[model samples]
Target: MYDDRERDTGTGRLITGLTWTLLLFALWLWGRGLTGVPHGTDGPATGDLFALTPAQAARLPRPAEPLGSALPQRVDIPQLGVQAPVVSRGLDARGAVDPPPFDQPGVVGWYGAGTAPGAKGAALLVGHVDTVTRPAVFYKLSTLKPGNTVRVVRSDGRVAQFTIDDVSVLPRAGFDARQAYGPRRAGRAELRLITCGGTFDRASSSYTANVVVSAYLTGTTR
Candidate 1:
């Protein structure tokens, strides 16, 4: 992992990470899937898929219980040379994972109320692919390949290292929420990085598809 965890953590303010006291409300929203980041890119057809290396199917032991809400301070994708501050995000009034303000498009927002990084379940990290002016934090997220490492430094002092397992681009109109957002397997620490990809329909001012990168925890450090 990069050696700029603490340094970068201090550089940006996090989007407020809040707990889901309204579990019922949050669950209803989760069913809607976490969709918020928008990028301005004129990609291929909606159903057109980008080829990715097959993921090495494997598994790992997970903690018997959830880690004590270890809030992520920063996320680093070594292969992509990315280091961005992470903030916690809760559901919007519409029950979707709200994106960080466009002005701070470089910042990433973790679903604070969901599975914390390193915990058993899917932890979400979302960032914009592009902003009103230029490319954003996860602009090149689709280029990430299997085995590429994503290191997330949490507030609890442990660094969770996740290995890319799969990448998918699906049409937003017929997206399978449970299939896309569901955990790859039970009882494992996993991470999902999401951003807008595919064609940017100027007619609607939104992308026609989404890029989802899935990863699983392989190791950690203090």
Candidate 2:
């Protein structure tokens, strides 16, 4: 007779592990898809979808506003060897930032629903560390340290440089989203680099925590 109890237990474990592996793999593939997009791009392409929740869709910043003019065009961090194009898109229902094209994976964009770049507030730039297939831009972002520099190239050809003053990892659950994306004091411009880090959980399809790099503007072409 077959030992049904033992057989079921083994099958359950296998299914659990396979589920996590597949979840992790799917996340990786999504990251790689961004790299497949063509480089030196200037506008949205066909099949390039940008979907947002009703709230996000309604909250899109108006270009006519002064704060809207502060939106960034590109982000460059020589210290970390990063120079990615910037985009502007609203957030999803989950509050997570939208993903970029796979071919133009060098792109990073402003979380439109959050703070605007170059504003007297926390400017957030989110990127993928690695898809299931390969590492993505900002993959080495955690390597940045205090005093390192991050530059932002504006649409008007001006450039703003920021100095890294701190880097910290916050638990996924403990992430203070509002504070991280809130307004800043006068004369202060902050930047935050976000990515997944810590332990990886296949079942949950996420990392244990997020790696965040905080910086402040020091110089600019203004």
Candidate 3:
């Protein structure tokens, strides 16, 4: 997160309580500058980052039904070689999505107030791209391409599998609440893996954009 006030601090900053709806989390972008995006203020030019053309939308698969009541315990992205524990988290006092502490950047945090991973709604899982010293769990999340698979091990001993539809790198200034956090289609189970991305500004200690990877339920294993 970029903050002119925290420009001197090497650690990234986080947006406090935002008035946005269920589509809640937004991490500060990274870059090598000292610009700051004030909390709740209108963002700079987003350059249509969230727009999906006909070609991009056509690549997404629409599932007929959702999964069962099992809770996700872990998320595995074989292509990225990412396997990490899932912890339920809520909003901070400021109403912003409360991410896991900086010391545990490898852990993924699920917005427990929303739909579960295998359920018939959009499930949101978020993590840090890096910490003060090194890269974090989702450092390579933006590298995932379409048709790649993500498996979520559930409490009921089932694995909920999702196929990648698309990935977007949205600038923090013009972040779209619906595109960033909404379900892809009605009555389908989807997942959005979010993290900070873009140019890292060593001067401000923030990134320039957020990487949102969109996926939908395709299969499950018992």
Candidate 4:
């Protein structure tokens, strides 16, 4: 018999072990599906897709110039009422970018080896959607829409403000890491907030898809 507990554990592990090497490889094979990441047993089903509608795209603020490199201290998403401390994390032996510990569900993990938030390249931030018994830091990530704001407080005492421009619930079958993680424009300071999305499959014990929220630096303040 399939147990819900197993499903929860599987989802947690699959997301925690998201590989960075394989994901970055998608940059060259932009049109090809991603590999190495675990997939659910269910058929192809992309979860709720939140993108920039024509009107929203027309209203998005201009991208701000990339800031000098600085460590991130916290991330704030006012729309979702999320204000969480950010911690630096590195890849594990298997090349997977380690996420925050399951016990630290309120914390966010930044890929330390990648571009810092507000820098020229796309910065990656990952968090758990939910722990076994409760919601996690990025639980409401998919609910964010284009034009919403994301504020990242940095060690340099500047608040880097980003504007959400795209949100996608990419299914596992053809997961495209390039689209999910790469910067949308050259030289732009970008950010990606990732979490598990879609239904959890008992057979595979993992969520069928991932929710990736794309945002870019648009403003800043102290």
Q: Write the per-residue lDDT of candidate 1 for residues 135-163, one digit (tens) a residue.
A: 88988888776667899999989888888
| Shift of residue 86 alpha carbon in model 1, Å | 0.3
Q: Alpha-carbon error at 20 in model 2, in Å?
A: 33
- Candidate 1 has an lDDT of 0.69
Worst 10 contiguous positions by lDDT, candidate 4: 27-36
Q: Write the per-residue lDDT of candidate 3 for residues 121-190, one digit (tens) a residue.
A: 6788888877766677887777777778999999989899998877777776656667667876777889
Where is model 2 more than 4 Å wrong at Cα?
1-68, 93-95, 101-104, 183-187
In model 1, where do residues sit more than 4 Å from their true spots?
1-68
- Cα deviation at 207, candidate 2, in Å, is 0.9
TM-score of each: 0.75, 0.63, 0.75, 0.80
In terms of TM-score, which candidate is stronger, 1 or 4?
Answer: 4
lDDT of each: 0.69, 0.56, 0.69, 0.76
Q: Residue 5 error for model 2, in Å?
A: 62
Shift in Å, residue 200, candidate 3: 2.3
Residue 182 lDDT (model 1): 60
Model 3, position 142, has a per-residue lDDT of 71
